[model samples]
Target chain A: MRIGKRSSKLMMNLYQRNKFKIRATTSNPRQGLLVATFLILVVIGADVFMDGAIRSRIRPMLVPVASFGRSAVAAVAGQDFWSSRQALLNENESLRERIEKMEAQNAGFEALRDDYEALQKMMAVTDEEGEKGLIAPIASSFRASPYGTFIIGAGFTKGVREGDIVLSEGGFVLGAVSEVNAKSSLVRMVFAPGQKTEVVSGSTGFTISGRGGGNASAEVPREAALAEGAPVRASIYEGRPIGIIGNIESASSSAYAEIHVVFPINLNTVRYVYIVPGNE
Target chain B: MSNMRLLLAILGIVFVFIAPPWLTAMCILALSLRWRAWEVLLIGACADILWFPGTFSYGIPVVTLFSLVVLIILEPLRNELLVDRRMI
Candidate 1:
């Protein structure tokens, strides 16, 4: 009884001390509004002058915390989930067939790579020196943002410079490093809203505009011959395939063809991206 | 009630990084209905830094703006619903 009374007295005293300050701010709604406006202006001013230095410093620290929370949630969700023996057997058989197809595809890619290297050596082309790549796991994803972007686990300390090309497995273009801090970096994907890139459609050149949500579209002249599943290569990356045309629609009112493009790899499932240096 | 508000504010900040954007926004809105939670703006700024690409010119910080709007809209509701119970 005494302990409970003492704790309640302590709480009452603490509340009494802060009561006036809280009322002074909340009683007059106009004062509260002014305070909020001033704070927002301060944030905007900081963003403008600091050049994102404040953000770079603070965001990297949260990467590990966010990753831990994600892992914990996944673990809790997986704990009660189970599969039957027949289901597991079926899944195992499917994986074996998939592995066989992947091996065949890998052999074909190795042969192509060998031929390309031989041609490069025969031509004596050594202008572009190859640089090592840093593999970084994704710390946070774009799904959390109102806009489409993601954070990677590597940054300036790991030699991840801005403008470095981020690629998924098989050299598929994911994005470029936009901001780098000490321990993490932000990647701006090719399909982020308002992001524009110069891409060549097979042989035809056009500028594609990002429509956000891993989708992009470009307008081509009516006379240009383009089809679904055509390769779209980034001009800045030496014609490297960035996306493929998913569909084509003829604008009846305008003299143009609307081409919809999509990235080959799913952004959500991508765990790690290869950060190729010297591409900036 | 105040203790609940404080707990919600902390959770809101944590959810900015771990949970979805809507949950974070809901927490901020709830806090604003009770007290002047300026931390919402800071949380929004952190969200922008973590997910937004600094290089992009067009993308604006939506969370901060949304928090400001909620605070403004909730001001009248707070005045009507909350009772002044503390003694000077």
Candidate 2:
């Protein structure tokens, strides 16, 4: 009788286990749909909530996460190694090019400096050298928001500050820092739809406003004597030259001048930037 | 669970994040083989949110609508392909 009871107890345990498994599998289909929906909602909500306040609080932690993702992919695809190789080749090429260009430019400078120095002496006669600032490699691209602007990945740790200037490679000022955090800062580029900037065209010597472009050339004042290929620079911050003036518009308003300045660095490909300290 | 699927998923996610406008379409095309219509749309939407978080506001509705249209139209075409494969 005791032996019979033990066998019956084992059978009962097997039946319960099979029933639990059946219930678990049966519920999984409905659970999958619910889980998918939950995930979708979360993704959407996170995007909506990623405003300045949240970003200011969260971005410090986020930087490491983003860098990890980038590095992991880069490692797996051998792109990191490839990029290092390419960078080495580029440095070698640039060094050779710089030497050649400097030699050519030195010859031209000798002739121009003779008269330019006299004009400079007459204007001020003070020889204060421009201070050199640190060149920080941009670790990542700018993070953009709707209510606010974009944030770059270099900050005070790299000697950047609120009023410091960001530059494109061709000596044009991109924008100034609207806000700065520990490791990164926000830059409000002059090309936002509502953004207006005062720019002096180096080639044309016309004072025009950069009204930004949507799909076509930025609108410039009809009377703002600017050619399409004119090089433009902006003093968004004092002593900083922003972007090159891009294509000129056939001005509609006879009163206002508008010009599109192409950002010196491809805004989309902004992997790195050089910050020029304002006080320097 | 398969290594191949995980590899593909990671590649798909990465493409969704950083792929330029031209390349995103290519990524979507590549994904058509293994993913259902809804899954592909969800992946793309996730990528957009990761990149421009600003797009999140307009992206959810737009992606959902786009995915629905793709399902309504492409699913019929896919059905034919699936039937052909099964027959072969």
Top lDDT prediction, candidate number: 1
In model 1 chain A, the worst 10-residue window by lDDT is A121-130
Per-residue lDDT of model 1, residues A92-134, tens digit only: 7778689769967885796577556544432331223244676
Docking class of 2: incorrect
**How do all models score by TM-score?**
0.68, 0.48
TM-score top scorer: 1
**lDDT at A87 for candidate 1?**
60
**Each model's C-alpha lDDT?**
0.72, 0.50
The list of candidate 1 runs beyond 4 A from truth reads A1-40, A73-131, A251-254, B1-11, B19-36, B55-59, B73-88
* DockQ metric for all predictions: 0.36, 0.10
On a 0 to 100 scale, what is the lDDT of residue A61 in model 1? Answer: 80
Chain A TM-score of each candidate structure, as shown: 0.69, 0.49
With a 3 Å backbone cut-off (N, CA, C), the pairs that clash in candidate 1 are none
| Candidate 2 TM-score on chain B | 0.53
- Clashes per model (N, Cα, C within 3 A): 0, 10
Residue A75, candidate 1: Cα error in Å is 4.0
